[model samples]
Target: QLGRCRSVKEFEKLNRIGEGTYGIVYRARDTLTDETVALKKVRMDNEKDGMPISSLREITLLLQLRHPNIVELKEVVVGNHLESIFLVMGYCEQDLASLLENMQTPFSEAQVKCIILQVLKGLQYLHENYVIHRDLKVSNLLMTDKGCVKIADFGLARTYGMPPKPMTPKVVTLWYRAPELLLGMTTQTTSIDMWAMGCILAELQPHKPLLPGTSEIHQIDLIVQLLGTPNENIWPGFSKLPLVSQYTLRKQPY
Candidate 1:
């Protein structure tokens, strides 16, 4: 039982690594096993009772997943205070986002291919299991010192149905968000993740975000600039989308 979970005292915090939507992650060393691990401190300070839905989903989904390209969650631990819970995860040297931000040169096409292949493999597994990674971006992709890429950050992930159920479009970072999502479409599928993959691939080539829009309308405009305006002829049922009439689209072509 996680209630009787081991205290976070078993791990020695090395340094703060990164922050996610649900928690703050730290690089730590397991005192008992003498192994480095990522300790994500679950954010529950505001919750008067139990875990956040995001944290709970991450834990439940990760517990059922086992793949080389997926980040591993080892165990859960609690801090001195009741709300200070932590998740022990496999440690990675860096994330793709940080690497892209810091690297002097952009990754070569071959290198990008390697990274994309790993991401696709991970996505394939998740999709096969009926899971949709609502948030897919370079920041959520981690890399080991050995160049192995693994998908991390499952806070926004959820299981999908074959018929495609309605979901929140507010998920995913704005830059990598899909056009349908931007148009206020709540029907989420693996296509949303695929759209993010396309953005990631483009970003890898330039070593920067493919579409860094200032706002939701600007985001749609950027997509139009890249892929041209969509019409009913190109994208069936485009005009009938809930938010399609909210903005006047620019006449642009890639």
Candidate 2:
């Protein structure tokens, strides 16, 4: 299967669409099938190693994922040299971040519900398969012209088994990060993604980010201000989290 991978020359790059932390994506056309696709060229400039671990993880996960709500990885293609590689993914017309930035009006209640439902469905599938999408945010959610929503960007995703292994607490974007993550909980679960989902659902209504904090300290402060400080009564063992003693939380009973 590795030897049969197609060459990047088979596709015609229409234009550059976007760039992610791991790669640069292009809107391209398959010359043979005349089908439009998203070509993501893996960034290997800084890597002395064969392939980046993030890209390898993404390729491994995407190849096994077969849900409509998840972005599809059609195939892996290559460039002139052995080091040059590209991922052929299903093309999306727009991402929520861009749409939110450019829209003149906010999404209607019904529309917001529809988008959230799709995302929830996708998250359900991921969780069922024991995959945790560590980085779930508006920018990672893509939409097709037909209004189909796809969860994209899997660089930080990981598959968890029983007892869930401890992971880095710094996986998610600060604005959408869950309180547990901010408090330095190493054992993560689907709750982190759900927390981000809540942020996305809230943002769609006002067409703005719910907690747009500039820094981690400010992010935690914003969350505390909105929902009040977490206590043992509400959040059992909240005081025992790894980083709980790092900051002095205000006493607010909201």
Candidate 3:
């Protein structure tokens, strides 16, 4: 992943990709090998509270992960002082987000299957290692020129051997979030990833999101409408959700 040791000033910036809450990603090229790479520079020093915890989590987790499906964190370049941290990573051709958006035609079933199987394999490897990728949205899936899928952004990811609570709602993206998580459960499970996989799988048919919800509540409603609402008996500790007891159900009331 870390190609040549680029001096912070060595990489020439091609252009800005997107401005995220934590940092700005740029497509940069190494002066030595002329190899293009993605540079993620954290805005830690300028913040009032200090370095964002999310950035720290990303750095910590990515450093430990060494899977072919998972994004590789090449090196951490210490800037003039400790304020600026530059993460070097392999150059991915595009993310699933960009691919789906730009594709004027629908993706073939085989193409979708091939892409998702790679994602699942990567996810399976992560789960087997006891690492949970809290964020498993299509945007996080990156592709290589060889059509390899590498899961990026381990900012929300964590290592756990079963949580003390139920499922974690705070982990995944809203649209792809799991029912157990949406119910405000905090127990982390491989099922959460599977749920996101379900969303991803559905998205592949037309290269669009399957259940795109505007809010968490709406997302839960869509799930109930599809799979039906879960009960404390079937789901176990269903009433324990912070928001669950508030509403009465018309269907599958248990």
lDDT of 3 by residue, 1-254 (tens): 12443456777879887544367788888787898988888877557775688888788888777888888887766455556667778878888888889988988889988998899889988888787887888888899999999998776777777434444467788889887777666777777888888998898777778778898777877777777768766777777777787666548443
Better of 1 and 3 by TM-score: 1
> Against the unseen true structure, what C-alpha lDDT does each candidate score?
0.93, 0.93, 0.78
- Which of 1 and 3 is the better model by lDDT? 1
Ranking by TM-score: 2, 1, 3
In model 1, how large is the Cα lDDT of residue 93?
99
Off by over 4 Å in 1: none
29-51 per-residue lDDT for model 1 (tens digits): 99999999999999886797788
> What is the model-wide C-alpha lDDT for candidate 2?
0.93
Error at 192, model 2, angstroms:
0.5
Model 3 reaches what TM-score against the true structure? 0.88
Ten-residue region with minimum lDDT total, candidate 1: 245-254
lDDT, residue 126, model 3: 89
Q: In model 3, what is the error at residue 103, expressed in angstroms?
A: 0.7
Q: Give the Cα error of residue 194 in candidate 2, in Å.
A: 0.4
User: Top model by TM-score, which number?
Assistant: 2
Model 2, span 26-60: residue lDDT tens: 99999999999999999897788789999999999
lDDT of 1: 0.93
**Cα displacement (Å) at residue 205, model 3:** 1.1
